[model samples]
Target: MANTVNIKIDGIDVSVEAGKTVLDAAKKLNIHIPTLCYHEDLCVAGNCRVCVVEQEGVNNLVASCAIPAQKGMVIHTNSHKVRNARRHVVELLLSEHNADCTKCYKNTKCELQDLASEMVINEHMFMDLVPDKNYTTDKQSPSIIKDDSKCIRCQRCVRTCHDLQHVSALGVAYKGDHMKISTFFEHPMYEVVCTNCGQCVNRCPTGALIEKNYLDEVWDAIYDEDKHVIVQTAPATRIALGEDLGMESGSIVTGKMAASLRRLGFDSVLDTDFSADLTIMEEGTELLTRLKKALVDKDTSVKLPMFTSCSPGWVKFLEHTYPDYLDNLSTCKSPQQMFGALAKTYYAEKKGLDPDKIVCVSIMPCTAKKFEANRPEMRDSGYQDVDMGLTTRELAVMIKQAGIDFQELPDEKFDSLMGESSGAAVIFGATGGVMEAALRTAYEIVTGREVPFKNLNITAVRGMEGVREANIKLENVLPAWSFLEGVELKTAVAHGLTNAHQIMEAIHKGEANYHFVEVMGCPGGCIGGGGQPIPTTPEIRRKRAEAIYREDEGMAVRKSHENPEVQQIYREFLGEPLSDKSHWLLHTHYVKRKRV
Candidate 1:
């Protein structure tokens, strides 16, 4: 129960929980108050003052997003004063911001530009303040570009980096007119402890923060006559790419995605879900081997609570923040890297195509995948394994550029050889999906039965909670996997770097214990990735997750081990998980980065 407060807006009566912001109360009435600094996923920062409202008897307007509604309060969200104040606020934001909208990466998608259009601000309302400052643009990072000129001093990125992520890579550096967000020592993002998660890029209302897109490079690769360009789409990507292309959130556009990629003239359009299934195989085997070493051989060097390494953002976070526990991470490369490596090696050998002519591209739901693809260790195929890492947003751009009506395109299946996937791989879009998927396979491998849950759905580990835990008792184990029957296996799942830090602290303090851990750098895992869609919210992520689980349920094959492509690959190429060749192409090491 909550203390309900009654409030009036424009003579309409509204009742909401006590201490709820005026903006929240207005939202119940469907009153759309424009905002820039405010984000549903972050702590409220009322500094922008664009969401101001006029309260009866109050001479000055209050920020609707910050002011709590009280009993009998009369609020005017669009009163003359409020409208004028909001207009002036937008004008002020534009005064300091570079209004060169056409040249910006965020162009039509920019929030400030939207506000200007709504207010009919065709010209500056005040003196141009952008000329007074010497703004700097940082394009050194492979994942993100930081341009101070486009920043509106809105602190949304600052709050997202600090409060939501607990990664304070960006901070306000100066005061008043000189105030700006800067990294420590103003070092380029690549030179800092920034994990390149792209949460800041997602929250930014302006072009100040944008993923460094490789649209031109990818277009060039597609145009090369002698090149064999192949693109792999991630599991999360199909669940959200429709949102940017005029479809509703949670729309499964797998067929449309494949068709659009083919329309764009890619040599092959594959699914990363295929390699996601592969990851489960390699990672499950690694976990079983580690358990054998720790419980059976009493190996001192074996690390328990093995962490999943599917998220490049989480991998980089661990490298910078928990360098000493690098061994705890599963050595299996992410599905993207695994597919990239195989695209050049196994696929090339099977197709009899020269590896040099093969250009491997990945359409990911993450910006960090771009940075991950560029890592020196990812070059396992001798040349750059993954030539380009395109975000879902970038893919939408290409689709729009090609003039293909995405919704009108018919659904098509992914190409053979490395495109087939299981239901378990599809759920990799959600937060706790990895833990549930792994347990679904590992528990079966030990007990020789489907997971005891209904229809192989592990509900215990499937959720939106920050840090979740589950316990499974391995019983009636197969003779080969029998270390000790009746062993209760403990596992944990955490999404978001902040929650990851909390779980890691608990593990370090010996307050909590587990045999395995799943960590995703973003709030709701890959479905809520930094590169999925702009304006992602709790509601939007929930919809995407629903789409993911629904897609999983509709699939004929629900377990990773059941995928025939995986079985064929094992039989034809790798032989088994963690083989010598698997180590050469599917796994690598991590380096401890200097802590800031």
Candidate 2:
């Protein structure tokens, strides 16, 4: 039998795990305990005393979120003392907080705002401690905005940055009254080593951190008659967009999303999955070439454990922190960037439209994509390939602004040529998906046989583990790849920068030996990206992953190499995978940067 602690919450006896918090015990009974700094993903932070509850024989109200539920402990969550203490705590936070809820980016979704309403705080009882319009807003980063004035100092962003991401780009600076979050030496965000992952933005309770929205720019492009606006939606966007439109979590709105984009006046509706498939071809081929050189020709210069570069945040993380391993990174651009390159080049030429007149917009489940699109090296097509990158939230706002009923929209299909994709492409939304997709193609190419898996599902690489590994022993290799045919291809997958750091450290210390590695910037891969739907708990991410795999299974073309559109792109313009044209248009290089 499991160790249990018997506690009485509001005179109702309950048994909870011994180490569980009082808040956790209360939640089992559906008791309401408001919190601002508390997040299911991060460690408990009792700075916000909103979850305080009255305990018998205790001198002061106990912070339910930080205190353990002990046996025979009597707790009253709604006692007069507890209510006043909680109300006072919120009022103090409100006093220093910029209360312009109407102008805040997180007006409705703000946890502090919601708690204030729940606590029935109509007016501030204390003097306003906020300086009149004298706060600093750090807008240097292309992906996120930081407004110190609206900050509630919850430290959720701090923990997320340091503990979850292992990128201590944010930390407490001053002490006492002047204490606040700050980057090293108060440098501008862009100048620091921040990866612009937006994990901090996702954890922030107020408008202090948010994605730098491109909604107005996209709106202007849509309204312009001269501009030929085209939008490409990412794989993760399809599964999570429904959440912002009042739909349930894990709702598959792929067709509805495509329809909504068309209704928003896009000249063409395309899929980023097309490029995701193309990434497999390019990246898989690159892996094969490296393996062949290392095994067949005995080349020592080729970097082993080739890393996937589909995640821009991971790319920037490596650039800033692990410059020595730059060569190990695959040269292929991310699916979003690849789509942008092709949209302006292949799609533009097919329709005889001038690339300059074509406004290429991308709907992504990542804020890092905004920064990725603006990189100087991204202008490979004689113009900025992707004109604008909108987050899932931003796209939802656009849909609402256009008054499109997203849930009621009819199912629609993406435009031809660049819109077709495969199941391998759809699964790119989840962690370890790229590794699985690459193996699906690489194994088939070597042996001339499909992967020996039921329903083409590589379950070995399909889970929520932070770091996962799989090995495939090549059998019955074709004559072209007949290097004795018993080589086991070792590969690994890691999501979230902290896990990525672990994998990188293992590789650097020579403790891990693998042929290829896949790293995603956020937890649960792109399904839990920094720009994904808010309140992104493990349960929500699992639901989204389930939806992604379901979409993958429903597809007729389950392999990247089977995509007819990818074949057509190579046949008509690109010639072949890693061809001169493909390299010029589809792949790019990364730069090493000094870590701040």
| Residue 354 local lDDT, model 2 | 90
lDDT of 1 by residue, 540-569 (tens): 999999999999999999999999999999
Which residue pairs clash within candidate 1?
Answer: none
Per-residue lDDT, model 1, residue 142, is: 92
| Candidate 2 lDDT, 139-250, residue by residue in tens | 9889999999888888999999888788889999888878889999989888888898889988898899999998999989999999999899999999999999999999
- Candidate 1 lDDT trough over 10 residues, lowest sum: 158-167
TM-score of 1: 0.99
lDDT of 2: 0.92
Error of 2 at 309 (Å): 0.2
- Candidate 2 clashes between residue pairs 3 or more apart in a chain or in different chains: none
lDDT of 1 at 501: 94
Tell me each candidate's RMSD, in Å, in order. Answer: 1.0, 1.0
